[model samples]
Target: MSGTDRRYRHGLVLGKFYPPHAGHHHLVRSALARCERLTVLVCAASVESIPLADRVAWMREAHPEAEVVGAVDDHPVDLLDPAVWEAHMAVFRAAVPEAVDAVFTSESYGTELARRFGAAEVGVDPERTTYPVSGTAVRKDPVGSWTFLGPGVRAALTRRVVVLGAESTGTTTLSRALAAHYRTRGGIWSETGWVPEYGRTYSEERLAALRAVDPGADWTQVEFGSEEFPVIARRQDADEERAARDGSPVLFCDTDSFATTIWHERYLGAPSPEVAAVAARTARHLYLLTDHEGVPFEDDGLRDGPHLRPWMTGRFRAELERSGRRFLLVTGSPEERLRTAVAAVDGLLAEGWHFADPLPERR
Candidate 1:
């Protein structure tokens, strides 16, 4: 039969997928090409840090056509022991009860797995050459294997750094500098991303639309509605997510959704529960609050908050502390701020991600 034609009536692909990488996706894709119907079993153990449901979701998202399911298989791996093998098979069978026509895998145990199911063994890439990556390698050094990871996994694992503070406090400058510095590393680091403040774009667009209607209209004539904060916050959050998914290990965002809540207060003179709710949707690792003391606020036509700088800075500090968000207050010249920000970001990265040890003896 031709490769495009389904050779198997049913097929199974199983793994811990402890944070699915490209290699896992390759195997699933290869299996789908050969089977009329396929099931991806994400068998996670109790000791794994990543939740079983998350693994199942990632696999499902990556291979939407396949039936993706999860099973907690805490039982230790002992392929040589018939009793242990039977225990695993029971879990596997319970999760995927239908008889398998073929078992597709890049693992050496595919032969035994297929034999137990009375199915044929189809090995996609027994060697690591096709995609030289594994769950162990990912867990050990995610930054090193960043490109091998898919967007969902990358978004989940990326270290998000937010540069937010009073206007004219060098948030944009520092954020751009951080992204550029990381790009100097070359390789995957060249993809280091920086998310622009969506609020600025919104403001520019609003002003332009207003000027189009009345040629004399300016920033003073611009108005912000309380309802608009949530929209900007959501858009900012989405932009950050997009950048994180495509960027390197670290993502630099100049003013994030959380900052939108503060700007809401600046414009509307009160807190906004709507914007705060939207801001809570995503996680940001570190906040660099730039102090407005030494820097002169330039009236860039879009900003009239120079007089409110101290209050804004104080308010940002209070909110960050009140909400128990991790942050660092930065001061001095642009050079000093960049140096301090880099040190803080490097420190955050030094504390590597912690992935709980999976059940002993992996396939």
Candidate 2:
């Protein structure tokens, strides 16, 4: 078929494309071949890890003839703030073109997205598609599946791994151990460190702004309940792609959204809806929990007071279950925790999990 004749008239594919993989290739190729023109809306947050330019470059390389476009910024602010789902709908309606005929996705949210955008929703079946890969899977085990990623992507995945945890919970120790393990396994390990505790840095300033908006507002409530919790939660997601590129089989997060959930519950007395949603979005496997008693609780700048050993651990377990995420809870001494973590990684590898980086051979 002639290029013009075969192109999609108006079709769109929207995703983080942290590093677009063969599965993305399958969908885009199909869309390009079916529609007169295909517009790929690369999420702005995706740029944090794989730059928007690089993601677009990979897409162009894979489907050279397809018409691809980049969305300039993060999904509307309301989209990230889960309490305002309706507001997010309004933003989606305003931001996305009304003329697009179809929207393609492998996520459950695609249906709602199609309705909001006034487009037909096409589901991409990963198992039946050209490549069954997920960004989550790739971040967990990049080295083992380097063959599945593009050249530039493979290079990006090799530079950073972000380890996160609650205060005094052995995050630093585990991150170091994981780095050592990766090197021992003949892989390079790089640590970009944790997302800064934005709450501590900006809490007073944010509270001041809130008070300015509503002079009669309960400043204390807004401080802990409103601003502090959510800021830290949001920062957690900002680091995902960078950690993926740092190219380790597993990102080896010491504490993740689950820990954040416990923090909100314990400190704020109730979990912020925003933090809960962030937990859901960023929750993934390879979440390693250190034994509360074994890791000496110290009052680091971010971590203070005694570690909530029992309560937090239980909360972590519950949140993981509720979120339907698989996690490895490492108890006992430091040595025991390390042994357990290694076993968990091996188990995941044996299950045939592949990361999102598209192998050159597959391309």
Candidate 3:
């Protein structure tokens, strides 16, 4: 039946949606167009890698036009046995509130599902012609399947790569290089190039504001206090999250909140709980530590001093080791550093690491 002629009062679309991608979005959107009220059942099993609640929330947010519900099926996927159908039918009946007039699906199993529901089966992109992507393909290589993800899903899957070290250690330079490289390879989904160091920009702008208000104030000796570190940490995290939401497959962060915590220890001679909390929350997948060796320290006005370079680098190393975060020490020319960092990320990809997977532990 034509879409305009056949409108269902109630439609049902059911799927595991391991990590909902563009195809699922297309299916749900198409279904919503034909039904006055649609119900999307996000079926999740215990053995699934992605959390059930998370999948339901994703579908709910993605399709606000429809009523989305989470359905948990602890039993194994035993499609061949007819006995399992009765149990499956019971689960569906309990999850869905009302009678479904139509069922929307892209799989062959839709025939049986519709039969059980006693509803008309409506197929969408059965051959995968319209949106040629699947959850299985996404789970294998999320970065490779960047085009098939929505902003919310993409943000969740964006792998944060932080380039950090003492001042004048080429952190900004390397961060940009890595971002450019990823963009060329179709990794970055955002137009902003990369997630730059928000702390640096924040400090500079604040210093300028202070100098403007009080011209006689010694802005050169601006003391680092607990008050500012927390602000910087939060800003840095927000910047990174914005990049992810904009569709960065591999987000290159100049410095993360973890680096902010280390800096807090350096400047205040103690730990800031706020900074530490932000650091723990915004942890990155990989870190490229820019070594201070052979790099001449230039006075950027913001830097503490040339003598503090070694101490800063040492502190960063100690913190990284203590936290047991995965890191690769990068040094030498800009080209060499970029090459090394890229290789390390490639190794991570080779391990079947997908951004949609659970965040890796500190290692």
Q: Candidate 3 at 306: error in angstroms?
A: 1.6
TM-score of each: 0.94, 0.50, 0.89
Residue 310, candidate 1: alpha-carbon lDDT: 94
lDDT of 2 by residue, 1-363 (tens): 854344446888887676676677777777776777777776545326456777777677667776656654543433334445565454444555558888777876778677767888877784644575766656666554465676557535433233344456675676667656755655343332233334444555665677798876543444355556666766655554455544444454444544566777877788778777776764355566554766777753333456456666677667667766666666777777677777776676566543333222110
Residue-pair clashes per prediction, in order, are 0, 19, 0
Q: How much lDDT does candidate 3 score?
A: 0.82
By TM-score, the candidates rank as 1, 3, 2
Residue 234's lDDT within candidate 1 is 91
Candidate 1 error regions (>4 Å): 1-6
lDDT of 3 by residue, 74-110 (tens): 6545666677777878898999959999999998889
Q: Is candidate 1 or candidate 3 better by lDDT?
A: 1
lDDT of each: 0.92, 0.60, 0.82
Location of the lowest summed lDDT over 10 successive residues in candidate 3: 354-363
Q: Which of candidates 1 and 3 reaches a greater TM-score?
A: 1
**Candidate 3 residue runs with Cα over 4 Å from true position:** 1-4, 186-193, 354-363
Error of 2 at 245 (Å): 3.0
* Best prediction by lDDT: 1
